[model samples]
Target: MKRILIILFIFLLSACNDNAAVEELKEDYPEIKEVAEQFPESVQEKLAAPTVLPFEPKNVSLTYAGDMPGNPKRDILHTEFIYGDGVGVNLHVTTYHNKNTTWSSDEKTMKTVKLKDGTEALIEGDAINVKQIRWKKDGTYYSIMLIKAPKVEKEYTIDDVVRTANSMEY
Candidate 1:
């Protein structure tokens, strides 16, 4: 009985932590909160968005990409936040129901980083710019990509992407 009580306490504590994290994300990104509220609780939990972004986005949009190719029941969600028409930061956050799968990249360009929750995230890019950050948590795969844009004065760095990934609430 004592052991069961202890386990229950731990579970409740973790749930509270998750709730706090979700509240923080909602407070930090009202757009995410607004859009997420439109979905069911199950879908909302899978639709994780970053609390941090590299640039101040001029526009933000979320799209339901339907199911994954092989898995008809698994859904895909794509959220995009962009800063400029064609020349500034364009961040894409994609979430799907799957074991964490990462995009193929040259081995030389891929490295792993530990997120705040100690999840291993695969980052693919060069020394100066980060192309993508991918990680999996709670049976869901999440990816954040910096889409190539023309006439950009500055490109986001690996640190920027890492910060964004860490800010994601599962």
Candidate 2:
């Protein structure tokens, strides 16, 4: 009877630990966890979502942008997080499975940054002030862009975008 009691106690402790883990995941990835179900299982396995954002987005959307041309197995996914009204801040995140291709810019403002995990990323902006930070992990390329419309008052810095990249959870 003592062995049976010990086994029951262990099972209860493990159940509690599992619940705590789930709760922690939900806390860290509330928005992503809510929307992750919309993706197919294969995509979900490859997808990494940001645990932090520059702002609290009023709207979040995830879209499957179809497979690569000529190669039906490679997929493209896009996610957008929007804050404020018609002409406000828009953060775009895109991921695709493409091992052969990487992106770079010739703009004078372009620079490279090292992420917390030692991955290299590029940040670039055009004359119009649109900025993008891009990096690759495990043959998957990821990009985050900050689009501030003409009416928006605040200008998001490259550091903000870099922070978003650093907070990605795989």
Candidate 3:
């Protein structure tokens, strides 16, 4: 009976530890209210808060990385998801602020795709490689970018990235 009790105690402790780890992972996702201030002016003008989250992989967690502040090339916001123990996927969302000139110049090298919603999307690189998809809606220029991730454990495919973009509600 004493041996059984010792084993039960060990099992309970291990289970509790796993739960704590999961909880810690969940806490990584920042509260929108708290991270709102990190958004660039153009993004703030367009979105009340950056709350669009795509379909994340099971056991993978997503966390807000805040706006890429002070970047001269673009006004961007970022979210990072991690899974497979250490692999990460960074999602970058950018806005051009209703500028036709900028949009035209930037998308010069990108292939154009028509989304189901009739939105014209400009894509750089295929789903298998690093990619950036740009589109405009209601005068707000937006982009969904997947940076090169470490090829360890599990890697995301192009279809995954496209699905992530389509999952965007706002």
Candidate 4:
């Protein structure tokens, strides 16, 4: 019963295209007004035009596992970069482990052309940071975790390292 009340309370706070829905329901029931009245007008404005909602980033998505690639001490934070005509850069900062510099140390000349649906990245010694552009796969979002140091590097592997973050809604 308590959980039901709480759930109803939260629903009352959510944005609505019309107030009539609540009114119609409440016309036969008056107890809902307490929960509705607690809501601030600011949140209500979202009904007209929502600025932000619970949404996963469009194209790319990261998945964090128990440990990171290459090093068990590291953790990956992943998210999909939206694939499109735009920009992105993945970052990681930690102590003890060197960021992966696989991109900077490659002797082979790297391709300069930006491939559509490719994540351009910056790499340091142990971190494989990629500036991810999104790509669609089986209707799921994904980003390549690659590394590129400024100069001097070996081959940059597509599966080097990538991490995902967590999100929750109330």
Candidate 5:
């Protein structure tokens, strides 16, 4: 009986993990992987609270499936995400940050652009600073930019923004 139970437990664990991985893929694109590949992992750790991660192409595909906006050009870190909550958003970020504009609502303003693909089923949500953390209450997705200037000021999501808002940092 013990052997049978253990086998079932392992199988169940594996199954659950697989589902979660798939769900995460569908929810948050492994955009972090792309950024991590180029930059040091410590960057993610050093990230300050209320940081608005640069929207990467990987984030867009994972968050929402569709081709990225504009041509696949360099310099501009443009991308878009698809949400299951009947919402879609595109992001256009720059690698260089103006020193004078280092930190201000000016850099954290919002803009409304049309999804070139125009095939996703989602509602456009508000911008979390320059970042768009929409809830794919319906897709799967994740990231910060590899070349960053610390302009991340928002993370719009259907869920609580500061989930750890109440939890301790222990």
Candidate 6:
């Protein structure tokens, strides 16, 4: 119940795409708002805008996850690439132009790591739990979230997340 309430609170906060927030985001991420104006004719076209992982785990496939048009919490071009099952890896790719590179993720819960390409990344949570790999590359942000389920046999690691993040091609 506590977890549900927390999640609901976050959802409410994120869904508060009120005029003020939208205006603030327009100022904060103007490029994203510009892109939003030119949002592709179709969601399929928008899905084609993001860089994809060059190397994917066996049996894992990419899917077109939808977007929230006119979202005000952040003005971003969002494309999601789900690498395995919903119980496996959920990669969220967000493109926006902002000087603020920091994410809402709690720094206390994340450990910083340096990627092979010399880029800095944050590993959220713990390795044995639902971990996420977050990094900013070439002005774009990539978040690789690992979802472990009871029936899922595959066990993912931080290395796997980093490798997948590294394999992304813009």
* TM-score to native of every candidate shown: 0.61, 0.65, 0.51, 0.19, 0.23, 0.49
lDDT of 1 at 77: 51
Off by over 4 Å in 5: 12-21, 24-129, 132-170
The lDDT for every candidate, in the order shown, is 0.65, 0.65, 0.52, 0.29, 0.29, 0.52
The residue-by-residue lDDT of candidate 1 on 60-108, one tens digit each, is 6655554543564544454333332344567777776433445565745
Q: Number of backbone collisions per candidate, in order?
A: 0, 0, 1, 31, 19, 0
Comparison by TM-score, 1 against 6, better one? 1
Q: Which candidate do you rate higher for lDDT, 1 or 6?
A: 1
Q: What ordering of candidates by lDDT runs from best to worst?
A: 2, 1, 6, 3, 4, 5
Error of 5 at 40 (Å): 22
Ranking of all predicted structures according to TM-score, beginning with the best and ending with the worst: 2, 1, 3, 6, 5, 4
Worst 10 residues of 5 by lDDT: 161-170
lDDT of 2 by residue, 1-170 (tens): 99999999999987654434223444555764675555555665566567678877666555556554355554544433333334577777777644455464463456788899999887755334577888788777888887877777776788888898888765
- lDDT tens digits by residue: candidate 3, 1-170: 99999999999987654434323334554443244445554544444112223334334433343335455654444443333222455555554443442455666666777766878887765655366676777766566666655563345555555655565544
1-170, model 4: which lDDT tens digit per residue? Answer: 99999998888776443545334423433543443333333322211111121222222211222243345344322211221111233322111111221223452343322222343332223334343222222222333333344452343333223222111011
lDDT of 6 by residue, 116-139 (tens): 789888887545646677777765
Q: What lDDT does model 3 reach?
A: 0.52
In candidate 6, which residue ranges exceed 4 Å CA deviation?
1-77, 86-102, 127-129
lDDT, candidate 6, equals 0.52
Instruction: Report RMSD (Å) for each prediction in the order shown.
Output: 6.7, 6.3, 13.2, 18.5, 15.2, 17.4
Using alpha carbons, what is the TM-score of model 2? 0.65
Window of ten residues with lowest summed lDDT in model 6: 43-52
Candidate 4 Cα errors over 4 Å, as ranges: 1-5, 8-141, 151-156, 162-170
Is 1 or 4 the stronger prediction by TM-score? 1
